[model samples]
Target: MWIFRNKSFKSAYISIIISTLIFASLYALSNFNKIGLSFYDSTSSSLPTKPKIQEKSEWLTNFVDPLIGIKNGEVFPGPCLPFGVVKVGIDTNDAGYTVDEAVTGISRM
Candidate 1:
C-alpha cells in the first residue's frame, strides 16, 4: 500500500485501468478482428462495373483452318470458294458463370 504513494505507481495504475478499458471495449465490439474501429465502411457505396463486350460473334471471310493448315472445310457441302465466309465455333468470356474458353456455339466466320 505504501508503494502506491509513489508517482510511478500512480502512473502505472492509471495505465492499467486505461488498458483494461480498451480491452473491454474491443471485446464488446463485433469488428474487433479488424484494426481501428470504424462505425461505417467506406467501400460500401460503389460496386465493380461490368465489361463492355458480352458475346463473341464475328464473321471471317476466306478463313483458313489453322490446325489442318488447309481451307478444306465447307460452308454447307462442297469446299467454300475463296473469299467466302463460314461459321466457326469459338469460346466467349463476357458474362456468365462458366469456365473460360468455354465454346457456346458456332457463328459466322
Candidate 2:
C-alpha cells in the first residue's frame, strides 16, 4: 500500500501501525480477559477496600530529593536500589516489546 511504502514517512507510519496494534491488543485483553486481569473487574461493581494507614517512616515520606535513594560514598546501602531511571533511549529490537515511546518524547533546543 502507498501509505506503508512511503520511504520518507517510514518512521511515522511504522510508529502509528505499532501503536494501533498495541491499542487493539490492550482493548481485546481488557474485553476478553485473556490476560491476568479479569474483564469482570470493571463490569461488576464492588466496594473499595479501606486504605491502610501508616504512621512510621515520616522522614522517608517527606524527602523529595531524587538522589536520596542513591548512595555514592561509604558502604553500599543495598544491592537493589530504589532509583528512578529518569532517561532511557529505546532500541527498536526490544525483545518484541511493541511500545516504542520516548522518556522525554519532546525536547526544546
Candidate 3:
C-alpha cells in the first residue's frame, strides 16, 4: 500500500488510522446510550429568551479625578481611565509627584 512506501510515513499513517478508529469507536459507543433510549431529551424544546437591557442611572466618571492626589504625599497621580494600564504623570519624588517638589520629568506606569 502507499502507507508502507516510506518507513517514517508508514508508522505515522498506521498511528493515524489506529487513532481514528479508536476515536470513532469511542464516539459511537458514547452515542449508543442516547440511540437506545427512545424518550431521551438531549435539549430543551422551548426557544431561548432574550436578556433584558438594564438602564443605569448615571456614570461616576465625574467623581473620578486622575490628578486628585498629585499635590499630597501619596501614590502616583497619573491620568488614566478606569481599569487602564498606561498612565502619564510628572516624575518628582521616589514615592510619587508632590506639590512642593519641582517637575523633574514625565513618566509612564
Candidate 4:
C-alpha cells in the first residue's frame, strides 16, 4: 500500500484514521437520542434541562481566574464565552517581553 512506502507517512496516516474514527464514534454516541437510537426506555424520555442563570458573584468571578503570579499573569482576565473558538483578552506584554502599562486592545488566543 502507499502508506507502507513511507514509514513516517504511514504512521501519520494511521494516527489520522484512528483519531477520525474515534471522533466519529463519539459524535454518533452523543447524538444517539436525536438519531433515534433510543438508548433508554420510555421512563427516561425526559432529558435534563439547562440550569437557570443567576446573578454573578465574587466567588464565581475568582473561579475562572484561578491562576496567579507575575510570570503566570499571561492568563486572560476578560469575558469569554463557553467553548468559544477565539479567546478575546488583553495582551499584557509585547514581543519585547515588556509589560504594557495599560491593558489595551483585545488579543485573540
Output the number of the lDDT-best candidate.
Answer: 3
Cα lDDT tens digits for candidate 3, 1-109? 3536689988888899999999999998788878775334658666566886554545566567766655664655557766757777777656665677888888676
Worst 10 residues of 2 by lDDT: 72-81
* Cα lDDT of model 4 by residue, 1-109, tens digit: 4538778988998999999999999998899888677866657747676887775674577576343433445644546788756666665446421243565565677
Q: Candidate 3: where are CA atoms >4 Å away?
A: 37-109
The root-mean-square deviation over C-alpha atoms between each candidate and the true structure, in angstroms, is: 16.7, 23.8, 11.1, 16.7
Inter-residue clash pairs, candidate 1: 60-109, 86-109
Pairs in clash, predicted candidate 4: none
TM-score of predicted model 3? 0.31
Clashes per prediction? 2, 0, 0, 0
Select the stronger candidate by TM-score from 2 and 3: 3
Better of 1 and 4 by TM-score: 4
Per-residue lDDT for 11-91 in model 1, tens only?
A: 989899999999888787966547777766757766556777534454353364544422333223223446666534443
TM-score of each: 0.28, 0.26, 0.31, 0.35
